[model samples]
Target: MASPAGTTARHGDICVGLMSGTSADAIDAAVVGITGAGATARLELLGFGTMPLPPEVRRELFLVFDQAERAVERLCSLNVVLGELFADAARTACRQAGVPLAQVFVIGSHGQTVWHQPERDSTVPISTPSTLQIGEPAVIAERTGVPVMANFRAADIAAGGQGAPLVPYFDWVTLRHPERSRAVQNIGGIANVTYLPAGGDIEDVRAFDTGPGNALIDGVVTLLTGGTATFDADGRLAAQGSIDEGLLARLLADPYLNRPPPKTTGRERYGLPLCRRLLEETGLPEGALADPAAPFSLRQRALDLVATVTAFTARSIAEVYRRWLPPIDEVIVSGGGSRNPALLSMLRAALDPVPVVTLEAYGIDSKAKEAMAFALPAHDGLLGLPTNVPGTTGARRQVILGTLTPPTGIVPRSQGKEGQV
Candidate 1:
């Protein structure tokens, strides 16, 4: 079907956005129709879906992520491997929206973040702030026949920024309210918050990573279940256990939680290593919680660990807000962690008197919010507009984000392999 004569003029071009966050849970794709440009632009979600990463691909990706002696060949190969998967996700999302791939103007891929060093390391010689997101945009362009805007973080980092919490640009554009100062908090693999002062402009925004989101919780659950569970479903395990105040206090002492704005973190800090350490502290070993028939005392210790970590996540976020942000009218929560009642209940208690609500209340699919965020940047990049918020990223100046990869006619070598290639 052909678009109406004024459809493009009125509703703008059709674009696709893709992201695989630190969790490596799945690749999220959003097919969005955006109209206008810059802050005045509007977006309508045409379609959205998620594609799970193959187990082997995720395994190799994590190996490279956690290991100090990461092989160049493995990183090189997995980059292309993930590109094919991201392309597949784009096509799947477009198909779901009944929009032909050929009609899509661009694809914005955040890729899988293998490692992110947002600050200089004093322990390592010549260490500078750097980051790597590994799904190759060139491959996505080749397979989809659509231009791709990727590597969005490097430019911000180049300008002496943390190259993170990029979604503040999106929130400042779309969610800022005239009457209310809102904290748009996303509890993904890593929790970050964008503070939008009531009726303030982009320059007034403050954003940063509060600390671990579902990463630590999910890591603990995955370890406990011996691969049988990837997350604490609806935060059931946490709800059933008792919070160990001593352990929670220790977890809260993490310096990252107290660090001020324009900062970021990832699986590099909050992933499996932290989970393993917590398990060791609890005197529980791997798969200790896997057996349903385990001794009551043993299982309770494992459950208590889960509860403590859940409190750790909530307290970190609340503490950060208390330490830095101005009094806000409300906190609008989103991401995978928003669905966890145990976490939410704790957060609500910690920040009593402040209304806490999900993005769903405002008519947005929480799962698709971050994936959809990249589409706006992609659209703005094509228009030669800057999308990164300097205040949020700590960049010296506002600069356009992403590198563009124009479409080519060649087929991708790993089209049919999934991750096997």
Candidate 2:
């Protein structure tokens, strides 16, 4: 296919996007074609694939990430493993699409973030805003022989941005309908939403984290089931359990729930320990807290946690819109959370009066949304164009968002006028 006019392409740009979100379950790889400009850019999804993390690897990663005394050497080793896994995924995606490795112009990898402390400052050696994502780009580049764009968050942080909810730029580009006020809500490890007002300017668009998503519910499931299950699959567990109103209220009282936009959060604030603490604080019994312990067994506790966590996500999103957004027309959901029927039901009930839809309804696959978002930013970086939305990320000014890791013997091409390379 010939590259579209005014679209940045040096012999046509075929880029692969890789993302392993806060959930730590799997890595999503997508091949995309970048064409056109801001608000008009067209992202063609050529192919997509997912590589599941080995069970043992997932457990080790959870332990190292959730605990405080993680060894440095182990963390270092996992970085390479993750890089190779990502490279393998990229290669698989290319093969599926029938695109040669060398033909791909770049790869945008949102590496596995082990920790994110957005509040970190000079005095605090490790605090918020100090985030670390694994999977070495050099390894990916060397393995795939394609230029890799990784560690995308650090640059946004360097420019004084929160380095999160970066997908809003993509959401705005792909989901903004001319006649409808739209909101793109992604349910990953943490839930976040980007609000695109009907007929609103780019400056008017808003995005922020909307509290816990599958992370807390997943953690609770693991604890209650003794690792038999990784998450409240299909929301089946949650469907049986009753929402402990008191516990639900307590979880919703978190300050993060009431925070304003331009904010972000991760597993650090809503992981396993926090879930255990919530349970302990609520004084729930070790066994089934409800009368029917058998049916609800592990399932009940998982559902209870899902109810509280998913409720928090829904209410937090509503709070953002109530406080900042003007009359939104519809809510479009994406990510793993969208698949949980129970959670979706809860969200629909909570967000009543306002319609709730999936990003797939608008022609974007829910699971592949985040990967596609990173692809847009990588495309922007390649063109030396600003990618971060200053209003949303809190950056001092607009700036291109990533460092380019070129393949051996290949030179970085310049973006000509009209954004063509």
Candidate 3:
């Protein structure tokens, strides 16, 4: 059931955070016990787990990502479909933590983003800056009987912000250092970095999308395997092959890489379409990619392509640091890309002398960082606090981020439940 307006969570209340990144690989859920609010907020991870998206659901999500081309009905049905899946994720996290559903104070869901156009189209007169992340909060609330906080981006966009890199709020609250400048780098389907100046306040934070992360590499792998494989698998293929310097150089030339901060990009720019173009440019025939028994020469070419894309992802991040970010004492890496050794090796080479480490070194799960971040914002929103950081997101002013959907208090006897880079 909905709490009275303005009523907030008591100290040590359990909260759940749900996230489905651009990879759309799985729903990451974290059940956390939160105390305090805003910068003083403290979060204790009770339990965390991931539930992979079903193949069919992932297929539909890609179609929708095609944007303005898919049928309206598909988008409509997917909204509720994702909501149910999200609810399941929340419940799973609680169960894993041995916490009852009734004990949860709220659920914060960063719903799957199908489209994000934070700026208006120059070619289309009617286009406006808008964003959409669709896993209906009402459905989540009804299913779990817990108040839900969602749509964390729209408010900032409406305030003339990029409405992205919102995780910096989390970075600021929990990861800031007193004596060391740090770049909290996350490499999901897209790579982004948050620079925290040593001992600086929230206004000193800086962040932006660097370029393609695992998306291009994952796209190529999926295409070459004819959907049998979706990623480079710890970058084994990339490690075996060689980088195509020409393709890598061409990818580095992307304007988005040079675009100023407060900018973001998604599948619309780096998705499967770019994967096909890169393959065509490399002269790899479609027939060879779909064949398991391809000639040794063609197989080598596939590996080379993966290596090149991984290099591109790493170089893009290093390039951004050189061009925009201040000198950093260290870089704390997180997200799916951190698992790729080849990608990490390339990143280390690109930024020599800068210590690069993972969140795990600091006693946090890299995969769970983003999901846990949202738990704080949900906690703040319930306390009627603003969570957006103007310096990072370019918002006109500080603004509270989510729209609250009060719980329906329904516990069903049975339920049926069911992204791209």
Candidate 4:
């Protein structure tokens, strides 16, 4: 239910925003309360929680994306499975927050992206920019008995946009400052930034992906440890190795990095295949990355590769600020990449005088920021507002960003009802 215009509404509604990033590592669910509207909307994060994808589920999802054109059936089945996973995560988050599931009227979900082609290329046969998010909204609504909104990126693409960097809308709403310009940079699997001009309006926002963040770094680490390790674990692996400047320079020369804003990327570009190609190009032993890749014994070549990829992530990010962005007075870092000391150290060096801060300093849980982004917009989207930022996604016009799966009269699931929503 929307409020009368120009009248400030208080006592927000309870809603849940579920996010499954490109990493497919976990389904993060945030229990949030949203009040007011437009720039006046205030977000109160009641609670947050995450649930790791089962190892088996993660492997199948990888199969769906790694060789997707050939794995249509896997892609089809995984959608339902991922939806179930999302429902469970939402329940867990509500329980953690002491919020009743029945009271959660809206659930905003940014489902797992199986594939994203921001442009039509030799590989992508689509006539226009396209993207797909799984975790069926119908399934989520049926399972949770709450109206759900998912598939956030497609509407922007339909309007001739990149359908990326939707978070800028959220960043501008929550993190914008009255006087100082801000760059809210989120480094999840892929790094992206939203530039907010000082005392800026929504149209003043600019954003785009800054190439790979943990996507490349994590891929190489998984290969090196033969799946024994999922990530560098606090940048320890990178800390021991020295950055290879020559290799970093070549990586920086990538065309994707040089491309202008209104751009987006995913596993399609920076996944395992890219890591394997880098290994071959760097002359790091022919079979070092064969099936069951070599373990991380901290060998000289492995160490160098790790350090090189890490530097590439950080340097590419800094390069974006240099190339685009308005005069930024502060940088607020969020997402998984912020946890990497080595990555942050390199970023600090690249941005020099501009102060880089964490989302925590602003009362946000860095890890849960993306989830919150979806949560706030879900509430407003239900109130009949457009959430996608035209400048960031290159949309010709603004459009409502989600498809809803409405809750019915069936008893709510949390009340021990044994039926679907």
- Per-residue CA lDDT of candidate 1, range 329-395, in tens? 9999999999999999999999899999999988889999999999989877766788899998899
Taking the tens digit of each residue's C-alpha lDDT, what string does model 2 give over 332-376?
999898999988888888778999998888888888889888877
lDDT of 4 by residue, 167-268 (tens): 998899998888999889899999999999888899889999989989899888887767777788889888888888898999999898878887899888
**Which sections of candidate 1 miss by over 4 Å?**
1-10, 68-70, 408-421
Which 10-residue window of candidate 4 scores lowest in summed lDDT? 412-421
Q: Highest lDDT among the candidates is held by which one?
A: 1
True lDDT of residue 312, candidate 3:
94
Q: Judged by TM-score, which candidate is best?
A: 1
- lDDT by residue (91-172, candidate 3, tens digit) is 9898988877877777899999988887899998799988889889999998888888899999999888988989999998
Candidate 3 backbone collisions, by pair: none
What is the model-wide C-alpha lDDT for candidate 2? 0.78
Local error of candidate 3 at residue 132 (angstroms) = 0.6
Judged by lDDT against the true structure, how good is candidate 3?
0.86
Query: Order of candidates by lDDT, top first?
Result: 1, 3, 4, 2
Candidate 2: misplaced stretches above 4 Å? 1-12, 68-70, 121-128, 282-303, 412-421
